[model samples]
Target chain A: MKNKGLLLVVSAPSGCGKGTILGEILKDDSFYYSISATTRAPREGEQDGVNYHFITKEEFEQRIAQGGMLEYAQYCGNYYGTPKKEVEQMRDAGRDVILEIEVEGAMKVRALCPDAVFLFIAPPSVEELRRRLNKRGTEAAEVIEERVSQAARELSYADRYDYIIVNGELEKAIQDFRTVVRAEKLRTKNGNKIDEVLNHA
Target chain B: MKNKGLLLVVSAPSGCGKGTILGEILKDDSFYYSISATTRAPREGEQDGVNYHFITKEEFEQRIAQGGMLEYAQYCGNYYGTPKKEVEQMRDAGRDVILEIEVEGAMKVRALCPDAVFLFIAPPSVEELRRRLNKRGTEAAEVIEERVSQAARELSYADRYDYIIVNGELEKAIQDFRTVVRAEKLRTKNGNKIDEVLNHA
Candidate 1:
């Protein structure tokens, strides 16, 4: 029998290099990146159902009212949420799904799917985070300061995560990420088939 | 600060190829093979402190009374037990320690060190185990049957272990074992130093 796929929930503060780490992890096709359903219009060159499953605000609210959304939030005056059916379908088909969300959304996912593995990617330090934000040069000084403060709050939630990886060295962090996935597969909960295999052997 | 090494408890049924697997794992000097203490007299070429910490019955009982042993059992008119201090010393020095014992002893160690990782190595099947035991030619036919029955009992406890590796393909089992060890080291409990390093950075 095919094993059920693991639901991996990854969360990190902005500028913590989580995107780069997750990008490396997704290079292997074994993972299914969960696409969020958003009520906002697609950006330039963003394709529907690829960048996101774009929906009307009314439709999004209807789905929420029908309890179709796994987790949803109002972001920049638009609804952004995980479509429960797609994730369930992918997982039931034995495709490991990756859900990259913020702490609030991640906690919501945890409550919804307690079996999911919650991983937190952290920057090397608050100082390093400040440096990365400043180096981006895309935000105003006050905005960068605000992001840094927000990051400190996020870091406080690290202990609540099942695993934490400090994205200090890219290769090392990637290896750690892979190791967690590999080892988690070997857990007794996932390897129950071994008993049947042995029984038949 | 040096991270405390992991106390790995390995258990397997007889003729499950645990010794060979453990030999491969010990090829790396990062692990300290825990030497068991016993009141049984040493055979030829069995060196004290190397083969076993041969102790007198009085001494063994004394240590047991003083709570120096992690786990102990009386078998064939002799006391066999794990010395708690040696395991602690090795772990304090950041050297992972392997305690290869039976399920009863493993349960004892678990009670003492709840943080220890407990792994159970299993054979592909009871039939395969019987074949291996018969091939050894070291035991009588009745003895082999007894061992096969005992293995069945041990197999039932596989779920109690944190991880179970079926020794079907030797290399694959070894890789699974190594992966578990590597991934466990990355756990937040063991990687708390990352926070300190980041704070200092």
Candidate 2:
């Protein structure tokens, strides 16, 4: 029996280094990173489908009305949302799809996709998070402070996630992410071989 | 703060090759395999606590009456049980404990340890199971038939398990077992680092 792919959603606070880990995993090509559809105008170098599924505001609203958007948000007078049909189609095709978004967006996805595996990446400690943010050296001190506080607020919502991975070490975190996806495939809700085996008997 | 160890229970049908996979994992010494206590007399080379926790019938009865056993059974004239105190102590001390038991005993453990992780190992197919049993050559035709039917009965209870791993290739099966353990450790209920990280902040 062909097992349906996993619909995985991940949420992480700033400075957790989850981006690096996700970058490594997405390189495997086994996963389909979800691309958002938006009403925002494409920038000079942005491609319609590659960068974002650039769509008209009317169509975006129509998709929302038709319940095609998994999760959506309004920013700077533009609408952005994950296209649910693409995710569902990819998953039904036995291709795992990943959605890396913020905690609020993850919650919206959770409401829409109850079976999606929710993973929250956390830093080892708040001090470590601050140190990593400071090490970037690109942000001003006030900006760094703002991000740290935002991270703390985000951590408050971490418990709402199904799984929490403490990103203490990069290698261990990547392995944990992979393990979570692998194990979720074997979950009784996701896939069970017993019936398939018994039927084959 | 140190995270509590995993309380894991495994149930598998005959010929699933779970024993071989478990043997490979137990070589790590990170797991404490639960040993059963019994009232049967030790035969040659049977050592106390090694083969079984040899105890008198009266003590076994007393332990059962005191609710010390997580699960118990009687066969021929001997009583056998898993002591609950030791499992609790090991888990509290951050030592993971593995309980490889039948479906019945696993259900008993479930009632006692609500936080336990339950895994069901499955063969590739019922035909493959029969093939493996036949290759053993120790059992007669009728005995093999009995086991095959019993396996079907056990498969009925597989849905109650939290995760199901199909044992096809030995190496993949072993890795799947390890991945399940790793992912289970990251579950929100098992060892959530949110509070620990927040408290440290």
Per lDDT, the best of the predicted structures is: 1
Identify the CAPRI category of the predicted complex in candidate 1: medium
Q: Residue-wise lDDT of candidate 2 within B1-201, one digit each (tens)? A: 678889889989888898898889889777888888999999999999887899999999999899999999888989988988988898888888988899998898888789998899888778888999999999998999999999989988898888887888889888888999888888887876589645375
Lowest summed lDDT across 10 adjacent residues in model 2 chain A is found at A192-201
Please give, for residues A65-173, the per-residue lDDT of candidate 2 as tens digits: 9988999999999998999999989988888898988999999888878899999999988888999999999999999999999999999988888898888889988
Worst 10 residues of 2 chain B by lDDT: B192-201
Q: What is the DockQ of each candidate?
A: 0.53, 0.56
For residue A93, model 2's alpha carbon misses the true position, in angstroms, by: 0.5
lDDT of 1 by residue, A88-149 (tens): 89888888899989999999998888789888898888998999999998999999999999
Model 2, CA-based lDDT: 0.88
lDDT of each: 0.89, 0.88
Query: How well is each residue in B1-201 modelled by candidate 1, as lDDT tens digits?
Result: 777899999999988889999999999999999999999999999999999999999999999899999999999999999999999999999999999999989988888888899899999888989999999999999999999999999888878788888899999999989999988886776655446536655
Superposition error at B126 for model 2 (Å)? 2.3
Residue pairs that clash (backbone atoms under 3 angstroms), model 2: none
Candidate 2 vs. true structure, TM-score? 0.92
For each candidate, C-alpha RMSD in Å?
2.4, 2.3
